[model samples]
Target: MTKILIIGATGMTGKSLVAEALSNGFSVVANGRNKEKLNALKSEFSGIEVFNKDAFDLVKTDFEGIDVIIDAFATSPDQAYLQIDLAAHLIALLRNTTIRIGFILGAGSLYTDESKTQLTNDLIASDESTKPWRATPENQVYELEFLRHVKNVNWFGVSPGSNYIPGKKADNILVGNDVLLVNEQNVSVTTADTMAFKVIEEIKNNNHNQTRFTVANG
Candidate 1:
């Protein structure tokens, strides 16, 4: 059985990922800052191991034997710097591990065209309206750069649709490479369940290695 560690397991997307991992028979180590929520999840899932610790406290030994690390943690809009700091710390902590790291990232970084500059400008502008969303691609770019230079650890980052939330599963998710994928309606969206499925699917397939991409329903 593959062992997986999930950071930010109390959030909506994180919760769905946990459920999907459990259903797939993977051993999960769920981490969250909230003690109550972590305890509740522990009580609810028979095989889940819960950790109520801050990101800074994570250690290499904590992730020993883990096959993958799913990073779903985020900071508030005003706390962008904090998000970068946390990501740096996480990268440093896992530097020695041979495990793969799968980051649950925001969609703001995806490109709609061939020119990389255009997509970057658009993503930065959209960040204003998407303030409530945490860890925009602007911040993740640096995280990705750090991860790329690291040795031994394989890293993959996935960005969900523009409006991802708790919704009915459509079972129709579109996958793209370094581009913003949208539906026929021109509005990209994904449910938590679909996003979770993608995460598990990547784990099983080992696709999109050392890169980031976006997902939506089309």
Candidate 2:
């Protein structure tokens, strides 16, 4: 079995990924910074290991026997740059190794059209309500750009649709590369369950290595 460790496992996306991985019979470890939340997870989840620690403080020794590490860490909008910093830190740690790193990136990094322009530009231009929270998406774009230049670490990233909600999986899934994904109705939304399914499915398939992809409801 592949030994997997999930950072930021207390969040909606990370928790869903942990549950999906366990349901599929993988050896899973969930790491977080909150002890109370970790204990809550232990009672709800029957067979997964939990670790309480900050993601930035994790060392190579912590990942010694792990086959894959999922970087699901999140931060406040003002401190979104930590997302890119954490990506670089993990990339530096896993260089030249077979251990794969999977990142959950924002859809703002996905292209909005064939011109290859990032969706983040449109987001910044169009929405005033998102202005306060745009830093997170902007930093996520930087994270993907940084990952694209890395050649030594086995890495891949996934972007959720425009509106990523916390909910059950949809009946259908639509996946794509780089570009924003939309369903038949032209709506771009993905649930936590669908995102987790796609993530664990990618971990199992091992395709899209060193690249990023997007997913949506379709």
Best by TM-score: 2
Tens-digit lDDT string for candidate 1 (32-121): 999999998888886899988987788877887888889888766666666567767777776656788888776666676556556542
Instruction: Give per-model TM-scores.
Output: 0.88, 0.96
Instruction: Superpose all Cα atoms of candidate 1 onto the true structure and report the RMSD in Å to 1 decimal.
Output: 2.5
Top model number, lDDT: 2
Worst 10 residues of 1 by lDDT: 112-121
lDDT of each: 0.78, 0.90
Q: Tell me the tens digit of each residue's lDDT in model 2 across 1-218.
A: 98899999989998899899998899989999999998899788968899898988888888988999999898899999999999988998899888999999998888886678657446664888888888888889899999999999999999999898999888999989978878878888999999999999999998899999888888
Clashing pairs in 1: none
State how far residue 214 of model 2 sits from its true place (Å): 0.7
